[model samples]
Target: MGALDFISDYFSISTRRKKRKAMQTVDIKVKMDCDGCERRVKNAVSNLKGVKSVNVNRKQSRVTVSGYVDPNRVLNKVKSTGKRAEFWPYVPYNLVAYPYVAQAYDKRAPPGFVKNVVQALPSPNAPDEKLTTLFSDENPNACSIM
Candidate 1:
């Protein structure tokens, strides 16, 4: 019986231990008006299991959490504190090719950041497009070879 039990445990898929959550950072945008708001938001997230650290920047209205926790769960935890919370939607301006595009620009975003949205114009200088345009009759600089 002991031998049979050992063999079953070795081959059974269900006997494997559950995998631990991976370390990750979750950034949330929460409007924190004052020190109290910051403390509340920080405490709410830090109390959750597996949270390693919490940072709140009231000026940017952002909370950064580092740990082995799900992002949605952290967002829900922030919302539970009666504050409107959402995932950070801004990316560095220099990272985007068309930073001034309608959907990507936001007046409310902090300096050097823009809303993360699909560019309105496809890249005009794409290699494939450049190759096509080089031989097309419409290009003024196209090779004169017929």
Candidate 2:
């Protein structure tokens, strides 16, 4: 075969492999109040073994985790953080949580609310401030789900 043909075939095989390896998405209902809390939720869930990405919408009170993973593990992971979490029972067929591309951040309290929060709070990751450290999953072997 020609060089171009060989390259095309090779790339197609690799692309298919990558697509097949893509992780599943599971959304979990989370309890989050503010930007800092949202950051903590994302940080915690993103550290999981099979987790690809985590998006937390505090205003909506939802956390969506996209990864080739199960809801139970994610639920357990969130609960470990002192927050109450469950697969959203509101969904029909008992869906864990409704999946969606996370939407806009609307801190739509009255005007000047967020600005006041910024002024009232310290800078992100301030040296003296303590941040929540997420726990490593109990099973280290599952991390290779890439």
Candidate 3:
């Protein structure tokens, strides 16, 4: 009986399953006024397939969902609960001197913060500032690794 079953299984065609996209964390800003709102938000996201966990912070009005689920789908699920939801915009910690401040929550980099300003843009009529510097190439070690 075992020999016949083994032979049949071995001859069966193997089908390749579709590869899934990389897993990502979906952070949504949903305002939950009370316990009921928090419960509803949590339940909606938890019921979604492939959602590993749902964390709702009522004080901060933030709902963080981690799993292989799509971010848009997670946002939609939260929105289905009748609460306004938007993708959480993240600001890099190091860029801002005071990240916790309310003004530092801008979608783009904060004021007076310069990032990746390696090269100055070329202007047709402008004077060459490169020629004005006195010790331009005096030190070979002045080159930045970045």
Candidate 4:
């Protein structure tokens, strides 16, 4: 009986260590319109146990929370503040061009999606070299008054 008790105690300690999960970071997309919305989300997430920090980006509508916490728990806490929340989904624009990559080009992409490439356009300040109109300055009928 004494030998059995010693073995059980050793197993219990190992089990406890295994159950402890490492700290993780979670990013969630939450649409915040004003300062008040940002405050509400920050306050709600900070209250959760094991939360070390909460960062909110109003421009990007993103909230990042870090600590030894379960992602689902943090998400639920933010949702409780009367705001819609979902895990942040990010995909690079370059990857979108290659449909062969299974992960990059998903049919479930967010709405109003556009590539991140820069578009080149003719400068409005540049002067036109030639005019194709019949009313050009050099044309004889340019001025009917003449």
Among all candidates shown, the one with the greatest TM-score: 1
TM-score of each: 0.77, 0.45, 0.57, 0.56
Stretches of candidate 1 above 4 Å error? 2-15, 122-146
**Which regions of candidate 2 deviate over 4 angstroms?**
1-22, 92-146
> Which clashing pairs does model 2 show?
23-68, 24-67, 24-68
* Ranking 2 against 3 by lDDT, winner: 3
Model 3, range 62-88, lDDT digits (tens) per residue?
A: 899998898899999999999998886
The number of the candidate with the highest lDDT is: 1
Poorest 10 consecutive residues by lDDT, candidate 3: 110-119
Better of 1 and 4 by lDDT: 1
Ranking by lDDT: 1, 4, 3, 2
Question: Residues 1-146, candidate 4, lDDT per residue (tens digit)?
Answer: 99999999989977775455678999898999999999999999999988999999888788999999999999999999999999887545544553334444445444433233333443445565234344577778768834
Per-residue lDDT of candidate 1, residues 58-142 (tens digit): 8999899999999999999999999999999999999998798889999999889999998766667899778877889898777
lDDT of 2 by residue, 59-143 (tens): 6577889987677788888888788987753332122221221221124322222111111344547754323212225445445
The models' CA-based lDDT, in order, is 0.91, 0.62, 0.72, 0.76
How accurate locally is residue 20 in candidate 1, as Cα lDDT from 0 to 100? 91
Candidate 4: pairs in clash: none
Q: Which stretches of candidate 4 lie over 4 Å from their true place?
A: 1-18, 95-146
Q: Cα deviation in Å at residue 74, candidate 2?
A: 0.7
| Cα deviation of 5, candidate 4, in Å | 6.0
